[model samples]
Target: MSEFRLDERLERDSDFLTKIGLCELRLMKDGRWPWLVLVPQRPDVSEVFDLTPLDQTMLTFETVLVTEALKTVTGATKINTGALGNIVRQLHVHVVARSEGDANWPGPVWGHGTAEPRSTEDTKALAARILDALKP
Candidate 1:
């Protein structure tokens, strides 16, 4: 299959997502749940299994690294990771930290509410903390 690339739609939406660490971390557009999205630098891969075995392994490691980082920084009650391309088909994983009082608590975070959008400064601070907590 061809390499994965963000489509025009995703690319356009990414502008706002980028201001926050979400873009740097290849995270998704959701603003709640202290979530993250990790996409391998390689571009037409759609699913994790589509990656070469080595890349697949690296993605798994990245997922764990991100999970640990979020847990430490956000003190999330649970770390939820998955890859659902119903929207963006790039081979990327979502790492969302769940808490009882979170915005989307007790339900999926996809469309329950409008994204409040993190502030540039706050996002940077959060990103820095996440980076500092990262092991790899």
Candidate 2:
């Protein structure tokens, strides 16, 4: 196995917030809605079941747990989850909370508009809140 989680490696390699959770819980980027990326930190794997049986099971369990937790946190009208890796082939699943009139209403969030970057303090506080919620 790799020394570090693939998601950890990606987070370290990027400037994004190193929020919380390793596999199960979501590390959301603080925003109007709860948008999460569930990434199993296994290396060189494309498919979900590419993981060992144990890891695959863990991933499934984690996905469900995060989905429910996100619902509780966001209270969204709908929850959308998908794995689209056209840009990053790192096997990450996205969980987005949906409402009736979101910015990308009736459309995909990607390529719809420029991302609204959160303020530093706001981002930090949001991350802290999510971390606290995900904590055991």
Candidate 3:
């Protein structure tokens, strides 16, 4: 089997945070929201069903883990998760924290506005908080 590699677009648009059982967790660079991306480590897979049964189970568990961690860290009113691979064909899941009056409140976060890139210091700080929340 080919070794796993992150898609170039994902690599460019996000910062690596940490890894879980079956995925590499990344923080999206857009500072508009507390967004996280979970990419399964399996190479060349582009859909959830493409993953093995074991991996599918692990993905579900990890997705929930990430969603809760995001909510804990951000205290968001609601959390959103999606796996629309229309643009990035990689099998990645998004776990986003949302509030009542965020920049694009009640609307989708994608394609609504320009991304405000997070500074390195800010990114590291957020990632550390998220990692801390993910601990058992």
Candidate 4:
């Protein structure tokens, strides 16, 4: 067994929000969209199928939980969920809130434009809102 560690690239691109069951829920720093990354706290796992059966179920449950919270907080028209590890080879799921007429409407958020990082105050406020929404 190995100790779990978040990939450096992910750590650089996102801010840690809170732990959600089997994963650490992080907020992407990009202000373009309300995005979250759920990284399973399991070492050496690069894909969802690599997780144990129980962990796989837990991951699915947490993903939905966070996604719902995001929708509630952002009032997004649609939610985009994905696990494309083409760049970062870590087992992480992305849950993004999308709305019509956004900067890149009817298209993917990735590679559309350079990411505009959120300010410190804005980030803190948004994180607080998300935390409040995640409460049971």
Candidate 5:
């Protein structure tokens, strides 16, 4: 198999955070919500079923870990997880920390409002917090 390459769209939309198990962790550039994405480092795989059974299991574990970490870091009231590949065909899972009255609230975060890009410093700080949360 070829070396894994992150989709260009994902690369453009998020900042590299850290790697967790079999996935490449990413922080969505949108500041409106504490969102994290997990992209399995597998070439040409565009769906969860595209992964091997072992990889699928590992991805599930990593997704849960990230969901918990995001909730803890953001003190979110609710957590959202999905793998909607409509826009970005690359296989990735989104673990978003949601609050009661956040911009969209009770609704989906996508197509709701403009994404407020995080400043470099802010993004770094958030990434650090996420990394800390992921620590054992």
Candidate 6:
């Protein structure tokens, strides 16, 4: 069997955050919103259903864990979580902190505008805060 590997696109597009349980946590480079992606460390699994029952449950817990952490860190008006694999075939869940009057406002974040990448310092600070929040 092949070992698990992160999708190339995900690697290029996001910054690696701390790992939580069975998932590799990542911060989307776009600073437009407080966004995180959770990718299960499983080989060739392109959907949630592809994971074992145990893995699926762990993923759910991590999703909520990430969502709450992001909400607390960003103080967003709402948190959006989804597993839309339309563009990236790798099975990953997105936990986004949304606010009214943001770049996309009431619409979806996808394709709303060009991504404004975060500064290295800002990204490191944000990642640290999130990792701290994930601690038990």
Q: Which model scores highest in TM-score?
A: 4
lDDT of 6 by residue, 1-136 (tens): 8999999999999999877889999999998998899999999999888999999999999999999899889899999888888999999999999999988887888767788989999999999999988888
Global Cα lDDT for candidate 2:
0.64
Each prediction's whole-model lDDT (CA): 0.67, 0.64, 0.93, 0.93, 0.92, 0.91
Question: 72-115 in candidate 3: lDDT tens per residue?
Answer: 99999999899999999989999999999999899989778888
Q: What is the lDDT of residue 98 in candidate 3?
A: 95
TM-score of 5: 0.95
Candidate 2 residue 50 C-alpha distance from true site, Å: 1.6
Error of 1 at 88 (Å): 1.0
TM-score versus the correct structure, for each prediction = 0.79, 0.74, 0.96, 0.97, 0.95, 0.96
Q: Model 2 misses residue 55 by how many Å?
A: 1.7
Model 1 ranges off by over 4 Å: 1-24, 27-31
Which pairs clash in the backbone of model 5?
Answer: none
Off by over 4 Å in 3: none
What pairs collide in candidate 4?
none
Collision count for each candidate, in order = 6, 0, 0, 0, 0, 0
Task: Write model 1 residue lDDT over 68-123, tens digit each, in one string.
Answer: 98899998888877777887776666778899888867677665767667667767
Show the colliding residue pairs in model 1.
3-43, 3-44, 4-43, 4-44, 4-45, 27-37
For residues 64-87, could you state the per-residue lDDT of candidate 2 as single tens digits?
A: 766676677667788888877776
